[model samples]
Target: MYKATMKIFSGTDTGIPNYSCKTSGPLAAIIEGLPTELSSQFSSLSRMYHYPQISYMSGNLFMSDTVKFPYFYRTVPSELHLCTGIIKLLKFFSWTWVSIIAADDDSSMRAVQILKDGIEQNGGCIQFIKTFSHSRTIPLEDMVNLYIKTSSANVIILYADKRYTGAIKYMNVLQIPQKVWIITAEWDFLSHYSLGFDDKNNTLTFLKTKKNIPSFYKFVREVNPALFPNDSLTDLWWKDLCTNQCPESIRRSCGSNEISPYFMHCDTIHLGNIYSVYNSVYALAHALHNVVISDSANTTMWSGESQKFLDFLPWKLHHYLKNLHFTNALGEEMRFDENGDLSIGYDIINTVFLPDGTQRNEIVGSFNPYAPLGQDFTINEKAIVWDSEFTQIPPKSKCSPSCLPGFRKLTREREPLCCYDCIPCPEGEVSNQTDMDTCMKCPEDQWPNQKRDACIPKVVIFLSYEEPLGIALTLIYILLFLINAVILGIFIIYQHTPIVKANNRSLSYILLISLMLCFLCSLIFIGRPGKVTCLFRQTVFGITFSISLASVLAKTVTVVIAFHATKPGNKLRKWMDSRFSYFIVLSCSFLQAVFCLFWLFTAPPFPFHNMQSETGTILIECNEGSLIAFYCVLGYLGFLAGISFIVAFLARNLPDSFNEAKYITFSMLVFCSVWVSFIPTYLSTRGKYTVAVETFAILASSAGLLGCMFFPKCYIILLRPDRNIKKFLTKNSK
Candidate 1:
């Protein structure tokens, strides 16, 4: 206690025996490195003397208790800020699993509790907490061996003082590399005592004050041995290293050795914690100046006994010290918080070994508690020089890598949520970025692409005339329609010819015209569907086929009745005229027209757009509004063809000259067969193929009727004109 007291107040001018000689005024003391035991002893004596005591390094929790130490204060921050800054640093590097090493003392134990609470609050877990004693009860070699064998944690936070140098030496003996060592403000890793650890590339030290202090450096260089003879730092100067036996030439040459190799100049050394001491002195001086100024205001004139007058009011400086706020000579803001501690800002230093045997600290990042929440901790990753093994990539301290795009996270069953596997998005859903929690659905008109990373537009489809199938069907229809026209023209030119007038010329003309219209109606099914074409296409197809089938029925009845009326007692001869055949054709055709009218007025086909059947496509088609009504039209046409087929089959073996019944029966058979297959094929197909099937059926059935009924007669009229005479026809009719 006597030695510490002399170091605090007594300089070369005042000896230990005469320390009470200059006691004229109230005085404040700035002390450094006060342990808890010494701080308690000093606080008791300071309270008894009524003088304020400010500590620069002691961060024990008891110093914050104003009731116990009323005059105690500190310029450095408390342990809470140190723990918070460490927690922030660990979280920035994603070091969730870590170990704790603290000294076996009450102050360090309290710091461990504070650090545990802070680490857990930031979602981190401590693997273990190991304590070391100053008495060396447990060997540091055994502790380091345990750390080497432990694979659970790669980060170790150490909260011990500089006296525990054995931990560093043990680590150096084991040659531990690639282990991250986190240190607090108390441990200066760049000091010469810790230089034995070769792998300092992974070491990070948190510091309360910056390493460089320009004003302090200038003050150190201006110190002369003559001015302050007993200054302790005078031995550190190279000028004091000269020997008295050295000559003048050698003495002048010795100037080269005056500069420090580490600091590059004689005055500048690594001023690690000395900045805190400088700030402490400035704080005490500012408070004392406030006291002197206040006292001089009440006095009439300046007196030489001002120090004596201020001695009577020693406790008055405590008020000014509580509220002292000023910028120090180093240009740092000097103020205390409500607990009489400075608001701590930490510099994250990366310790690297130089090419020589010395180690240097590089400032790579910082942690400021006064900043906003997320912006408080920042690091310059590019400026950092990592370990040799980890220079190509950053060290992996995370539980899992980040999920890539087009994938989502799926938490594992028995693991933490942060440690999970990535799963691809489901069908019809997509995730465009990395680590998406949920996938989104695409719109109805769009669909997911192959990779499921984006949505693309759908294609539109319809039966069009530009396709090959449509073009072929259209050409066949045109060719058959032209043949029918030529056959009609030939018959009209030879109106009196035997073959033209043999099988009812008017009915034949009507059948030819209806067949031509049937071929033209198929064009509606070839192109894109519209309202008008959908309404009229099916109706026109039904009505025209009905007309042609009625003509065949009338022709079949004429052949049967006319052959039977030539008998002696037959009454069918009276109904064998052309008018009866005409009435039969017109009445049957009119009934089909009425059925079509009812279908049009009640329910009809309309244009529709189908979107659901196939993905990534829209189908343009016709929707049969009333399916029953549409089937009724086909049923009625089949009825007409059935009646005609039955009557034509009965008279197919009559006199061959006037027997057109065989042609009608074969044509009706072909028509019925084509339409029967059309129903199932049209129902089973989808999109553009449905319309193509219906169009093909219409063209095939029409061509069948035209070929079976009219082609034979045309072959005889144009190729065999002699067979058309009355004598030959009478011979063939017998």
Candidate 2:
């Protein structure tokens, strides 16, 4: 917070607000008071004389705290805002790994801490932060030179005030080329001084936003020692800037040789806090004017209370100053908040040093902390003056580059967060954006693309009849069905023959039909599985195969009974009839039907999309809802086939007329072999291939039963007519 004083003298600027203005009349006053810079001495004087001490230079934000220094009002915004804005500016340029060197003072240290925290909080990493005193430390310069030569960070924040900036000139600082310095408006005076470096075009100064004061430039330039000779300070300032051949009016250009190198610096027109100075003086003037007018309205002409006594009343002017609101010549509304800080933002200016050792300040950007996030800091990259050697490319200052898509950042163990490695996303997961912390999982119906940066719908697959495997299986099932039909027809035409009637011909008819149905059921498993199809495929295969096994069991039992009853008038003769055979077949098939009904009611199969089974594919296959129910159906068929195989094996060496029992034994062996292999093959396979395994088991077992049992009967009935007769059978029976 700087306090600019309005002195009685007609000068360009002064430091204290001791002067007051008045009208020509006895009781009339126009502008009585104006304020300027505030010091400890000025603070005491302002309170003693009821003055509002407005600061335009001290630049200490906490000094505006109403309780600490009640009379003080600051024009410079908080340095905390400047720190916040600098962090934003660094992030905008992706400068995370920068160094910070601050002055060893209260305000500079505080600003540095805020800036450090801001950098880290916004994914920025600080390479190093060191403080230097006005009493220059040898290590500060050595470390600066070392870091400039060794460090990758091209940006460095010099958090110092004017005193430290002036101190920089005296130090034998080594060349710091290729570095971009971030300093405050106080350092803008560096144009008048040098830090022993030729390359300083990359400096960015955070200046308190100031507007042009109309003819302030003309006044500063034209009014040389000739006009302000009485003011020795103004005379001295004019002689340093002007040659012995000084111009009366700068409207006429001076010779470049006659002018000082400082001419270019002055022509740069770098204005710091002049607007703050103007407002501070104007605020004091307005308060004094109001006090004079109010006293006039009371019809009192400097009566009772002396003007000196009235100046002692601090609260009178304090109230007006706190409530003070006015528009300046620049059309900007200026006001003081409760804390006594002016409502103004900062301007980011780039200092481009020319070949003549003079500088140019370009307003490249602006920062307003009061604005919303993402809208607060703005920069014009095209307007900034970068190092010409780098071909105008923006400097890079980061510990690590950003992690691209399809990869996640892995923080190094003993380093900063910005120094991290990028690793590919885990299997089945994806990272769609750059610098993502974690990978995401795709849905069941979707999968990550090859790059892992995006998700696409999973390929829905099933054993469709149009596919190559499905077409092959369909052709095989159809050809087997036709073979089964021809065999059934051959048996039907030769029903009266002895070979067909050898062991219950009705049982053969029932078994063939059941085997045909089993073949048809296996084909249903090949199509795209719907709710109805998935429900029926397993149950129907179980029921039809059970019926065929039951028929073979009945034939084997009858052969055993018929051979035993003929031996010694045994009781097995009473059980040898078509009614008992039909009852055996129906009873065994009914048990399988009961199991199917319970399975359907409890947990029937349904269509499901199996994603995890195969990458990037959704197996649109049947889900056998109950594993126990599925095994029970398969196990029941095995039990029936086992019973027939054992029964027929014991009676395989019976009379020649009962030759059908041996066929039943061999057919049961083939049936049992197919399903035993099916379980392991089915369990091991995935997706639609598992369904293909189960369907194959059904077709293979059904064909095994048909070929083993009926192939011999068909050959003897058609090819050998003599063996088809009752006489040939009776001869074999004897």
lDDT of 2 by residue, 1-734 (tens): 23332332112245344444433212111121122222544565445444566677665655656786787776767676788889888988888889888887776777788888999999888888878877766766676667655777778887777666545665533246677778865554544443444555677788888677877668766654454447754443444455543334333244554345443233223454567778777776776667657656775545555655454445666777788787777887877877777777788988777788665678899987666777778899999888775533687776777778888989999998888899989887889998887888887688888999888899888888999999999999998999999999998998888888887889999989998998888898998889999888888888898899999899889888877888686888899878999999999999999999999999999998787789889888888899999899889888998999999999887766647778888988998999899889989999888988988888888899999999888888778887787776656565
Put down candidate 1 lDDT per residue, 648-731, tens digits, no spaces.
Answer: 888888876646888888998998999899999988987788888988888888888889998888887889888877665545
- Lowest lDDT sum, 10 consecutive residues, model 1, at 259-268
Q: Which ranges of candidate 2 are over 4 A from the true structure? A: 1-51, 166-178, 189-201, 221-231, 240-269, 294-299, 303-309, 353-359, 371-375, 718-722, 727-734
Best-fitting candidate, scored by TM-score = 2
Give the number of the best model, judged by lDDT. 2
Q: Model 2 TM-score?
A: 0.87
TM-scores for every predicted model = 0.64, 0.87
| lDDT computed for candidate 2 | 0.75
lDDT of each: 0.74, 0.75
